[model samples]
Target chain A: MSTEANRLPTATLPGGHLDCTGCTHRTDDWKTGPTATFLGLLLFIVYSTAAAFQGEHYMYENYLSPMYSPVVFTQLERTVTTPEGETLKVAIPGAAPVEHAWFGLKPDAWPEWLPFSPAFLILAFPGAFRFTCYYYRKAYYRSFWANPIGCAVGPFRRGLYRGETHLLLFQNLHRYALYFAIVFIGILYYDAYMGFFRHGEFGVGLGSIVLLLNATFLACYTFGCHSFRHLVGGRLNWFSKSPLAHALWKRASFLNERHMFFAWLSLFWVGFTDFFVRATSMGWIPDISTWG
Target chain B: MAERTFEIWRGDRSGGEFKEYTEEVDEGMVVLDMLHRIQARQANDLSIRWNCKAGKCGSCSMEINGMPRLACMTRMNQLPAEGKIKVQPMKTFPLIKDLVTDVSWNYRQNERIRPFKPPAPDSDGKYRFQQADADRVQEFRKCIECFLCQNTCHVLRDHRKQEHFVGPRFMIRVASLEMHPLDTDDRIPDLKNEFGSGWCNITRCCTEVCPESINITDNGIIPMKERVVDRYYDPVARILRAITGGGKKLPTA
Candidate 1:
């Protein structure tokens, strides 16, 4: 820690001054920015609203809970060679049914004591959103409502905006919250595992299978998350020197680089999984079987 | 020729107005061309910052239609004829004047990024890395520092933490160079605690505003943020990172 401060830039450039070599006069301060914050807010509202209503997020085609859609294989009887002399072929006797691991939200499982678990999940959507965000608090105050164009408006331009530190600092909870997120995945796997063997006696069913897949996709998305990787060991010295640490860092970087894509995809899949489970469990849609 | 109007902002720190300028439009005309014509015929002293109208240099970034963009890259034809086009400076920095903000803060934050400290090479002092390892991070280097992404970023725009959070675009710069396999820098924690790397909410405003089309959120910011989380919070990785000396650790299920 002591060495870090020594090596760090002094935060001041000695003998450095704003010479303004080519320019002339300057006088305006931060307080003069007009209320121009509505521009981004309006656009963001429009986009988020659109994203909400259009909720067809990433969903496994086979996990819709109504039919067992099998993987389509088209290589039953043919092969072709590329100009580069690469031969590729794939053939399956029939559409292979997707196997399940865990995830079952049985009607019987809904004990009265935990009656709100389903509804709670819905509310959790925005809750998860605020907790995991890396930029919203700043954007909300600056561009969402006040003004998108940055011009300070308070007298002396000093008070137009000042960030809140405590709430944001508390946001560090994302590290611990990741534990719950992982546990939820485990719960989902249990549901799927039950669904595979249950022959329809009020046991695990299609809902479990769909939920399991949702969790799997979400895991791919979450484990690859950028924030999660940072808490492990991003800034230490000899502490992170092991070969295992090196391997994990490499893998985390691989996943973290695609954080946005996975984030959005997983978010949508969670919603999709929930809707499928709801429709079937509520009897809004029949739990038909595709396999005899 | 259709006539068009521009609400060109005029004046300096003390005071200014949305001075309107009207110009004749013929065929292919760009925003810079309109400004040139205005400079020739109308307000000669209209102060605007611009350079390399070719779009490679990020010199002319401003809010076009309320979004941060390069004025030189926007075409007069793309805007709706019925509505007005509003142009302003990027949101997060101090305003120097119309469409120009003091971007010096970005460079200041860059100076704070933890200096590179790669593991010592073999006794021979040789390092090896394949092209595949360098390509993704290389994509982030196309940034011209136009500050459009910074302008578009909501964190710096709304949150008054310019002194703390370095915003996503700068994070991308830090992540790209530091993540370079041969480069020996460990910027993960400085990115998290000091630079406020966690402040970004993945809104992707930077990705959208980037003229270079770099995936600011996907490729640069998040990956670095993830590494920061691994080093600081994950128990297993924390133990591993302690032994490794600032390399990096992974996460578990």
Candidate 2:
């Protein structure tokens, strides 16, 4: 096949760098898609970083942020009152003391030699999970990388591209990261279980509701993962013979369709859950408790 | 008589605009039927391509209302009748004429993939495959080469990473050959280094636009990706490969 013969008869023009000189495929709505994605990711980064560093308010009487689950570093417990006027002490099991600085049961969750936010320790697991996620790869690639910015629009640069074969090889670690993400979901549900206990009695609070919603939304996003879909349903030749697998696959497919929606919703909602816990712990907001 | 308005693209690669045309359309008529009417009645020189008037032939792929789809497969009733139905060439490929694109780029890519290499024959001089194994490859065999998946893919459409990505169509093409039970060649190196399997990112946009409903991303691309990860990235697999002189080899039939 002759390359020249296969070429279209349209007038050719010189391609350029930076300016996208001589490109004719520009459209008016091109900026909207990349702009939205850019702002969304930027907002997430800023808010998540601020909340991660503000170490004082991650845990209140019963509620815990998904960001700081598994209770890796804690000093001790303290007594506090809910907005509903019930007094309860924060006595979470496996909750320990910090050796260094800031808030918690004891003063030193951080050592003199080590100065770091507790959120920093665990945020990377979920952070890496999202950063290496297939959906987020597309999100950041378009929004941050400006790789063409949008369809038919000129890209920022043109060059020899070896896609994900070299420096970006860590993207292949997504399936491995997914295992950690699944384990984190278990950790979060455990936090939700702890939310039901205030002074060893069963009760519901506004924080409890928020934690449950965060867990549910994040679970939806995690379960809807393309990797999860492949593991659960893919590789099988027969859905007919495997009825249980087929049923689970159908449910996964249903969630997969809404993965993008859940991704953004859970992203913002999880951040809000963190903020809610922080504000209430900081005494900026009041938590309404319920006897269930 | 109700007249359906269409803003059909009217030019070639150099420049183009959505030129408006109003035509009488009946219920159950498709966009391709309207295009055929426009060709016969209004613009005799207008260039468009179609075959099988049905959806099976992936030839008549173009953007209708900003989505890559088969012109024949899209029903006239499905689209909002209140506005101008926009018909344009696929943005990813270079435009040849009105509603026609030069999709030879996909053909060039298809040529790069290593074709199926069957295992050595037994005493009977024949290769045998289990029904289950055949069924696995059959899912991918349903691809009609429509290029809708290729056109809709953001890596190709938005990023123009043609140098790095082969789009979703060829991923499954390589997959169909790789997953064949009777095949005995390793294309994993090509998929890793040359074929751009690492670039796919698995958005499933290709699966969404597939008229054949092949799960191009989940079933085909992800499995191929895991294989690439296993061979190249897995630490345990790498150590085992070194000790065992590069893992398991397919048996001669």
Candidate 3:
């Protein structure tokens, strides 16, 4: 040990705490991660919101947009007599023909004020699932809510950090939302199956592949859920006795590890699937099909 | 050898200021190595708390350049080459002296959590379980009581909700016991009220700073939160339990 004379005088801290939030001493460009997350999530929100509002261009041939799957009710296909005395059917370009709708036509009791978009009926279930997702809660909390902005960084809002307890108590409903999402996956898979057939003819098309990939991606995301993982095996006290649940939990854990990747990928693919169906319906892109 | 400057905070509970010291850095030197050099050559009274300098002990946790990191694990090469390194005690905990903190609060939090209560052994006196059962709880056991997750948690660091929230370190402790294959204690009530699991916003700062790379947010905390929901908030689960008379009934205190 050195002599006492070698000791330096104790320095006084300005405040008890270092106030290191947003400190310049941090060498890493920490802002980049949250910024990228913000931009990516914002892009998805904007595009999905616009697509959900667009009532038309959701179906072409036998292919349906994942956004508008299980099409509840649709407008009737219009018909007019040509100059040559031939009756020709006309649909809002790319809109699903009346016969394709599960329910023949838009319900007469539908409130006029509410928009007639099939996407409006179904988006909320999957939306709630993704919104309350354990990974997405982290993503949006940092990127959107600016909860501490980034690790050790100062937050945009300071006082009354209730943190999912008060209004966000709804977030606990994520497990319930998982049930709805599982059902949606089944419906989407059915739509994918329908994509394989155009007017009763079994054939493959670009649209068929798009719908198939959309359903598959959504399935991966839904199955990889944190709550799903818990339900599968986490609730159990003994994995040795429940071999099936143990295996399922292992698979879910594997998928849960990549939940963030699948979350973003599926979000992007869902949007792209809608855009593809819309474009194909509008005749902007021809359906590359074996039928053709 | 290359000369480097370190701005080290030196003070007690009253206050502190960063004092700069220059030292020669060798190849493969960690931040702790440089601090040891400064202690030996310059400030003989320089204070630091460390054990098992290989990063397992987790005693040398400090804020290096504003990020909570283990000094023993933070290699000098990983830091930026140009700037002076800033070293300070963890902000969430009260500073005792220099880099040593009054980490007694963490121990107190650990004390509050109930220990694991497993079922009685079989007739052969063997507590046997499958490797898969052990594997789930094993991930949480890897935690070395680093308190890095606790330090980096915004609920404790920024909001200072220590009275309510048990911080990430203890949350995982509870997760390990709660998810154990044989352990059958019901801490869910305590987790909701006393431990304040809801205070965690799932910002994932704790997960990000974990040296053990434990999936604290996803695998640990969220699962616990879902359990809380099942007991307290989920009407569907409540209805199912009512109809079936089949769910893990909360143990009476």
RMSD values, in order shown: 16.8, 7.7, 4.8
Query: Top DockQ: which candidate number?
Result: 3
Across residues A124-186, which tens digit of lDDT does each residue of candidate 3 receive?
888899999988999898888878788877665557788888999899988889999999999
In terms of TM-score, the best-performing candidate is 3
Give lDDT tens digits, candidate 1, residues A1-292.
0011112122211111011111101122222322232443354345444433322221222333211211111112224478899987643222212233113222444454542222233334344643454544334443443433232221122244333334544554555666666655565565455455444434444655566676676676666644555544333222223445545656866776665456556555655554564455445676664442
lDDT of 3 by residue, B1-253 (tens): 7888888887787665667888888999999999999998888887899989987998999989888899999999999998788888888888888898878899999999999887899999999877867787899989998899998898888788889899988888998998787787789899999999999988888998998899898878888887888788999778887887854643211
Q: Whole-model lDDT, candidate 3?
A: 0.83
Native contacts, share recovered per candidate: 0.04, 0.11, 0.48
How many clashes show up per model? Answer: 74, 13, 3
What does chain B score (TM) in every candidate? Answer: 0.88, 0.95, 0.96
DockQ of each: 0.04, 0.19, 0.47
The 10-residue segment with the lowest total lDDT in model 3 chain B: B244-253
Candidate 1: docking tier: incorrect
Question: Model 3, chain A: how large is the TM-score?
Answer: 0.87
Whose lDDT is greatest here?
Answer: 3
Off by more than 4 A, model 3: A1-24, A77-91, B244-253
Minimum summed lDDT over a 10-residue window in model 2 chain A is located at A1-10
